[model samples]
Target: MPRSLKNPKKAKRKNKGGAKKGEASSSSSNGIPSIPAKVWQPGVDALEEGEELQCDPSAYNSLHAFHIGWPCLSFDIVRDSLGFVRTEFPHTTYCVTGTQANSAAANSIGIFKISNISGKRRELVPTKTSNADTDMDSESSDSDDDEEAVNDGPKAPVFQVRKVFHQGCVNRIRAMTQRPHICATWGDTGHVQIWDFSSHLNALAESETNISKDATTVSNQTPLVKFTGHKDEGYAIDWSPLVPGRLVSGDCMNAIHLWEPASDSTWNVDNKPFVGHTKSVEDLQWSPTEQSVFASSSVDKTIAIWDTRLGKSPATSIKAHDADVNVISWNRLASPMFASGSDDGTFSVRDLRMLKEGDAVVAHFTYHKRAITSIEWSPHEASTLAVSSDDHQLTIWDLSLERDEEEEAEFKAKTQEEVHAPTDLPPQLLFVHQGQKDLKELHWHTQIPGMLISTAADGFNILMPSNIESNLPANTAAA
Candidate 1:
């Protein structure tokens, strides 16, 4: 009754290429070439129909997706004092931010407001298979039919454009946390401009017409304050989260300036700029708990923490990485705790309380295969963080988990086995986001608990945790 006896099959001989005798022959029987069918190789465990795969890092369930046609270099989420979360994207026709006339003429920032509607929900339907017919007449008819079908389907999520701000390709935008109506932007012109949108918002509330039809131009409206101190294009800017009307900006010339608003609608820049880094300052972030404390990362492969009250010299300086440091974020809940992401595809968390001259990092994460472009800590959760990499992935990590000794040992062994394999997802990882191409920016929604907004070269996405449902209304506009 043995299974081998029942089959009674002869052992198959292998070919020179190691293929079985009958599986893939060297030649065809009809004098034609034999093309071997691709064999499916299982890289991980297979899943059954309707079953979900449980991994160490939980996956993000997409809630809303939007395509904005133009590539986005940077973006920010503005939460007004009224607790309304608005998304903004700076779109440019050019890939580089240059001072040429063409770059200025093609730059515009898109501002969108997300509102929840009642009794309406939109679901993603699978894309339909195209017809095999290649006839021009048939293709034309099919295209027309497809358009008609889409128009007849349920409404899509509505992203109402509140307004558009026309300017040179803005490299960075930071909305003041204390004064939500005020925002600061800088780009190729080496000038920092502060804009107040209170009047624009008021006009929109009073008018029933679409604001995009009569968009405002930056040239027409006067900025609240403008400062031109950088000798070259400014790429980094940040408004103090705890202080009103205080800002700091960094330029390509390796210069950092602090600005404070004056009474005559002008900004007063520090006579002397912070000047320790030998390379360009990549990012700047003010401490959430300390108003006068801030940190800056640079292409010099170092991170320096500065106290605004002090002149020139950074209070604390550390050689953070072997490569350029691209982004730094302060932990909102824990004072003295911050994280830095570098061009070497690694990020580390450090505690300022224990930082010394050498090896101040508390933990190192090397999961991203490409340079880290942006990093942010959750405002609501103490240990949660989000990072975007050039590899086109947005990952969320929960740093609260404590791994056992055995798991730690196995993780180290696997890390050496596969140098290029994604860094082992510590139990701390919560989600890995995909679908967006050339992802550049990510931020947590201030009002929504588990909502995240991301902008990439092709489009933007509004992501939600797997357990949460979509908050969009059913009657919203479709993409």
Candidate 2:
């Protein structure tokens, strides 16, 4: 059976409204036909009258969305000391996001502590087609509509947030693995600022209310270290996982700077920048196991592997994509495997061992129809990945999946209905989550298995799909 099928008896619900019957006989109040598309694409398919996206409660382990007043261009999941490998529900997680406010003075770094993420798991009623299928369709529609109406209102999770005044629009934000309160921000003013928000985090933890106004006013909002060495602003930055406090920042001018810890809270960024890519460096990822090694994607349509001890040049470079490579995610569990997303709405996985033998790319996919915005590998599942694109879709994929003809045939026979999917849709495609507008970036919670937090123009979405399995035992719970 495919990884997408959690239970053979309960098939995945593709569309909320019953599949289109035929040409519409009459229009509905919403100025659309009464029928909804079988498979809706964001830009391609239009919704029929009275057609709205209805969430299947059974399809989600936990789903919640919230807004922070401003749209963040980038955000990172702050690893908390709240025990690793969390499996139980009502999880708590910390995060930091940089805002692209209308005015530079209005921009601030937002730190959030979200909790009580209870599951929305429900058992779906099996649909039975009888009386020429029309009677069954109406019954299904009424049942789903009632469920959606009950869940339509905002179900905001408990959260505490703090704001630190930033000098300019924050292009990207990253939190250190060992010390999550220590965060790095790439500002539009061409400066990278390192801040220690230990006070803010401490106050938040102590606070009892959902909003932490005391914590918001407590921090000095001063960066421990500020480096203006980069001539131009950039979005690419990453902290080395192997070495604590080791950081790297890449710029639009094709310059990458390495930062070493000078003291406990300060960094000594090398004046000399690492030069290799001809165009802007789009993203950076440090090797999870190798202390001195890292990888970079660039607007030059290539991916380069670099080492800090190997001078200013890249160790190896590959023409990894047809268009500008926007993002890259190095697999933490499987160090040899990494993935890259491009401007042309495509992403591919590569293996370092195969790259040395001239066969770098292991699996390439083009399911997204717009520019790939962000991509990341699951910390728990080495073969699993999550990608966001300009197409307004956040897709989760399991690369371990392959087409199973026998399973498909058996599923159709047992369910009495074929699963609705395009012929070209890969079996590896596990889930497609929509509804967020202009999705910017996404990250998997390192401590919480199957949990994903994404930011976009609208706000933030914290979700864990029901179908994705976690290896962590149920006894382990979040602190």
Candidate 3:
């Protein structure tokens, strides 16, 4: 089951079994008092010696947790042809993950086809004083029999996985945006290998429970191309979204290699490497619109903008953070905007146009107390992004939000007794998700409007928080 998160306005209480004074608790049809939901701020809230956190099923639209045999340090959501802009219930998704095994020979890459994701869809109820539209008259006329027919309990989610034996402990794995089955892997052996998992993907999409076990056999698993050009092992790699088959891989030795498609199953990597960063390139992202333009973040504490046509040097570079930069995400919807996270737990959003003119960054936050592990912009929302840190928290942010004094005063007056939150928290911080241990990577499902998948040492969590609003049809029923 997926863990629950408290609403931001809800007070953090040690004992949530009973509602406090001034809070109203309603009884169910069986006359049992309902427990009010509460937020538990990590580090700030302490649990009783015998008490532990528990999942609140009502707080989520959908939540599921599962683990593979081994822990995955890095993973990418593999794009599938199931559907686009999927907003209905019972969602399915595909992804590729690289595992860190006890021995190099035991490591493998996993391609999973997870399905039957079912859950209650939430509907926002408007307050009496709110100016939102209403349909109480029409809703009252609806027959109770019609509602009962739609109330079947959610079904358990199912998954089918295909394993491919890797030569070494896979440091990172990424599926091509244009060709998801053709993935690239950065191995600890200081080599980058391209794999064609089309056969495995085809089998998973076509079959139900009878997927071929031979797909996991070592003899049948082999890379389409293995380039042993980088002097040292690294994790930085990305495929161009604008150009199919174009790739860039950066190494710990401060070298970046460019790969161009020589044929369907092969790539020709340039002998000379891009040499701008003085330290390890921590992450790389190709421009969403421009084929040759890309951005890189490094341990040198700087962000460099490079254009392949311009040469080996960076076209523009800036001291982005005070510490080593760890990851970056180029916004696909907003081409000029990008976000970067650093080793110091701070993440900032930047505008490429402003950077070129030497203007200040758009927004910066230091909310995470530990180093940031992964950060990515939502594929569907231009102003929204998700971030994960070593502190074992994943936070969702909407860049467009700002402190509204009038709204804040109204909200405080309306729910003064039931609501509480630190004044120091940024208004842009929309939601905070916890319960995962040693969070390493997170990705928003491009097909599902508000779905998210996060991988940690504890395993994987697939959740869709009810609080995060999305662009869904107005007639959709709420749970």
> Number of the top candidate by TM-score?
2
Comparing 1 with 3 on TM-score, the higher-scoring candidate is 3
Q: Candidate 1: global Cα-lDDT?
A: 0.59
Candidate 3: how many backbone clashes?
0
RMSD of each: 14.8, 8.3, 8.8
Clashes of each: 5, 1, 0
Q: Kindly report which residue pairs in candidate 2 clash with one another.
A: 32-49
Ranking by lDDT: 2, 3, 1
Over the full model, what C-alpha lDDT does candidate 2 score relative to the true structure? 0.76
Q: Write down the TM-score for model 3.
A: 0.83
TM-score order of candidates, top first: 2, 3, 1
| Candidate closer to the true structure by TM-score (higher is better), 1 or 2 | 2
lDDT of 2 by residue, 287-381 (tens): 99899999999999999999888899999999999999999999998999999999999999999988878858999998898889899999889
- 1-479, model 3: which lDDT tens digit per residue? 01111111211212211111112323344466644435656656665543355443434566666555567788889988877677776678889987776777777888887777666565543123221121111110111212211124433455667888887677789999888989999998999999999987887788665233234454347799999899999999999998889999999989999999988898999989999999999899999988899999999999999999999999989999999999999999998888999998899988887875774489999899888889999887899999998888899999999999898777767654445456778899877777677788899998778889998776677778766767666344332
lDDT of 1 at 415: 41
Candidate 3 lDDT trough over 10 residues, lowest sum: 134-143
The TM-scores of all predictions, comma-separated, are 0.69, 0.85, 0.83
lDDT of 3 at 288: 90
